[model samples]
Target: MRGRDRFALPILRRARRDATLTRPAVSILLPVRDEGRFLGETLASLSAQTYADFEAIVVDDGSRDASAAIAEAHARDDSRFRVVRAQRAGMVAALERGRAEAEGAFIARMDGDDVALPGRLETQLEALESEGLTACGGRIAYFPRRLVGDGGRRYERWINGLVTPEAAALDVFVECPLPHPALVVRADALAAAGGYRDCGWPEDYDLVLGLWRRGARFRNVEEVVLRWREHPDRASRTDPVFAQGAFVSCKVDHLRRSLLVGWESVVVWGAGPVGKAFARELTKHGTAVAGFVDVDPRKIGRRLYGAPVVGVEAAARFACSFALGAVAREEGRQQVRDVAAAQGRREGVDFIAVA
Candidate 1:
């Protein structure tokens, strides 16, 4: 036993032991806050799951509206559904509380506003077991079709495109490939990854990155399992915690801890705003910027943040241990990959796509 196997053995044993217990095979942690309008629909979806042997733990985080009552109603109607009341703690605190009360081999996440497809749990569990994934999610379709914006459609396509663990890992830094509401994770893996935290960024992204750091594999099933609701009151739309700057900060922090470890300097493969912002955060974490790589002729031969902006042809001359592809556009990111490969640099080894 060595490497990940050494860490994974205990989790596997724990899964086996938990399976033998009289508990539900899956525990769905649903954190609700003033989701009165949509709670009933979400609960109904959960009740309709093809895999019926699961408990839905609804954590009501001090909702002034009828959210708690709605959940209580569901609890009364369905024996497997239970409502836990907590006073005004945020989402992370609610998740932590739900996790503490979970008694299943696998822990699934659900949002009070999202609708889980009938086969969501059954499919995710099968993938987790068959593929040996630490956590698994599936494709999501944003509902109220007319309300879903261009960005939402793009994001939906991008997330649904990544079905394999390798595809998810390669683009993990670009965005959270796993839809939080669609996730079903191994209880032991979640516990080993330290559950959820109020990390000043999106908790879902933080947890995914933390799991990746611990050598946990992730995947997305090839079918749509969640009808993700898009509305004005959604936290991602209003919360500063899910802001672009916060996401960038989180990515750079994890990048510093993982790929940039022991490296004194790195070369950013874009001189645009995206690359500059990433480099700025990386610098704050004590990593020096060797240079910025750019294809634009005008931007080349300039200096930004005390680092020279050089053309792609001259980027390899920079004295840096690793290269971060921080281009914002997908086409630009792919271009970075092509250029890096031409320079004899490997994607995950010598370079990484950060945009």
Candidate 2:
């Protein structure tokens, strides 16, 4: 009872907590790396939450500096806040440890380097309630506005413009488009999926795509809830394990394991780079790829690396289980799924996952 068990109890006690301090239930989650520089401001943002009745839980992933001390300081002053230490595991493992200690009905995620807008929690909770969203994220505003370079600005615009929850399921190729550090999710849903599995470095995106496959609902609040901080040393920028190729690998592996399990022949859509790469990867794992599908008439009837590039029409001939969306665009992925459906292929069973 010294660790996770000691913390999970509040979830059971939440309903009976004092009405004076608690509001609608939530657990604010933070997994800190070497974030000593920004912890104070992050805690400031949490302390300002308009929606109360939540615990601020942080896990220090064996930082060599003041990260643990900063978190401990906050915990010392604020009974609602607690800090715990974990092995130098990756972000996903740290998130899992922190979530196990979460005592709220709803889990709200935040990054140690980012600041939440004053109404961030309230707005996300409201959207989660109204949308009946198991997972709800919101718009983001970039901080140190001058620090937002070209690539960061592009990501900001792209993520902020995602209008629908289906956008997550349909167009995940654009990276973890879910508003990082700004979403709130159902605690049970988080636990049901085994919290978060530390796999690829882009654990946030992996979790988002995973939840989509597991049938958890995600909603994007129209209002901005997080002030995303851009820095030269951001984990996505510094970590090679979080690269584009890594993202493609993560999506493909998850689809294969979950939806395409036990299939004799697997069809990969898109004859371009991603599809070809996926075919190469599957070959490494001894999975037989039936063929490739593409809308490119130039590549049609052509053989790339000995695999025939047939039009989408070829899907009817094979007993392939899933027509994986190998395309990069949202519209392109949908078109492939729609064509397969028209040909009597099911969504998850017959085909699944956008590149």
Candidate 3:
């Protein structure tokens, strides 16, 4: 964490206590990197949004293609559409530029390649204003390759199905609960997180954690707002920007910040991939692990990843944070939680889901 200035802090303070926008004005911010082919469709979706009191700020991130040309064309027709050109190639840097130039009271993040539904702005605004949530993203649908069989398809379905606040708690345990490309957030809250950082993969997940750390609520409207295109050329699908490993690293980085207690040893609750990954990140951050606990008889009483794998019973002897790294399988997690609970480990304060 870094120090914040009065300029940013004051706005955040006001937004925290005063998020009551009956008819909140919005600033639609889009960051583009060679999104020429479908930039028009994206802009058209924004144009069709039911919400009326908003302007578009498109940050052209040094596009080699005609992305800027589309922006110029859109600006020709509507004065509300604005373009900010970034000389560099950093996405976070581009987002920061857009934030600095935004004039909307509420902030909405959209990608230049993704399409927004006609009611996207209205529904997101409605939920944001009514609930006063600092962060909100609607259900996201994957278009074109909607019938594909890759795990990304399952990911899309799982993500789109999870929209409510409660579901976010569960879904975030897997990956980022709110779809990054589909979210609408309060400007003040964004300013509080020092804008967005290129911290790690799943920048959106990192941003969500930063916002949550600042005491902002995370939410999602059940209604689908954005059509996330699953093209091979997309940054998330192609570059290392939002890969699985990056997502894990990002989650652990932020999780260590918020969840790690000072010098307190952590008890990792699995010996599988997720468990080893969490242990590695925890160790990298200099957070000591009391030991690793597992139910697999073969893993028990053996050293895994240079850490002793202890039986579930051994956990009772240590007072430490338990990192539940079980993913997709909740029964084992529930059992681990049950064992921890029986030993008097409290949720949020003692045990945390790290998958």
Candidate 4:
């Protein structure tokens, strides 16, 4: 199955039923497979949205559980609910199916296991319609404190703090800048970007990078609009497509395609684990890293993965062309920025911080 072809005839017929109701202004494409335990809560959250001018297109992706029944129950109860069935296809196909059937001007993404705060739709729709942003996401809070890991907490904090496109763009290569479930995108823009595709990486992140490469502006709603749930079975924790190395490969591929196309030699800042990992991926894809820059005296003279590690001064004088800062911490990123500036490098032009 590919693109809109993923939706079967029956599913298509089910999706197109209007019932004389007004066409929804926003379409929520939520795909679930075997999520019976959590689907009801998610559907209820959507039904409770402050903005009622939306339709929730819940695609059941071959669930062998009560997931479909739960969705059907909700559809019977609410006129805004539309359920489509799929046969074990992954997220990208399910999303495309929902998009093809969507009649709304905007598309909002939701997962079967997450909860949407009451005002999420209202706030995001207003922001997109009024600000003319290509795509926008909101803050998220992960629930069940005991299940939330340290990494998740840090990510939440970092993403919530990024309110502007510039701030998000600076670290876009480091990780996915926006949470997928909390995002609202212009339907036409998404269609123009070729909808979603599985590029051997996380679908959501790839879409975001693709949109950004097309010069799409982004922003955050500055409000916690979604309650993200953390569990061991979540796709990010279980799917190979979302593995650490896959993310690195995805970033490297996108960087080469979008930002690093004409650049020949590049300087990598930060000789730590994060920096070395990214540098390795870049080198694997034929991007030459001139050297690594570090603040640590011990690491400064050492060689990391065969690349020379040097002091900030040496890195600054290494005939810089383009630099990628791989530091993961805020302070370290700032330090890299300062050193790059001292070398007369301009950000978003001469240099971009990866993490």
Q: Which structure among the candidates has the greatest TM-score?
A: 1
lDDT score for candidate 4 against the true structure? 0.85
Writing each residue's lDDT as its tens digit, candidate 4 over 1-355 gives: 3313322232233343353567777899999999999999999998887667678899998999999999999999987898999988898999999999998888999999999998897777667666668889999999998999888899999899878888878778878888999889988889888899878899999888989999988878899999999988999889999988888888888889877878887788888877888888988889888888888998988887677999887875656557888888877888889878888888888788886
Per-model C-alpha lDDT, please?
A: 0.88, 0.75, 0.74, 0.85
Please write out the lDDT profile of model 3 over residues 1-355, one tens digit for every residue: 2212212233232231122243236787899989998999999888766555677889999999999989989877766678887885678888888888886777888998899988787677667766667879888778787445567676767677666666676445567778888888888888878788877576678888788767677777888788887677888767677766677788777666775646367878888888887778768878776678888899898886577887877866566455554444555666766777787876666676656
- lDDT (tens digit, per residue) of candidate 1 on 71-99: 99888878788899999989999999999
Per-prediction TM-score: 0.93, 0.79, 0.86, 0.92
Q: Rank the candidates by lDDT, best first.
A: 1, 4, 2, 3
Clashes of each: 0, 0, 0, 0
The reply for model 3, stretches above 4 Å from the true place, is 1-24, 170-173, 326-344
Q: Least lDDT summed over 10 consecutive residues: which range in candidate 1? A: 10-19
Clashing pairs in 4: none
Error of 4 at 244 (Å): 1.1
Better of 1 and 4 by lDDT: 1
Sort by TM-score, top down from the best: 1, 4, 3, 2
Model 2: per-residue Cα lDDT at residue 267? 77
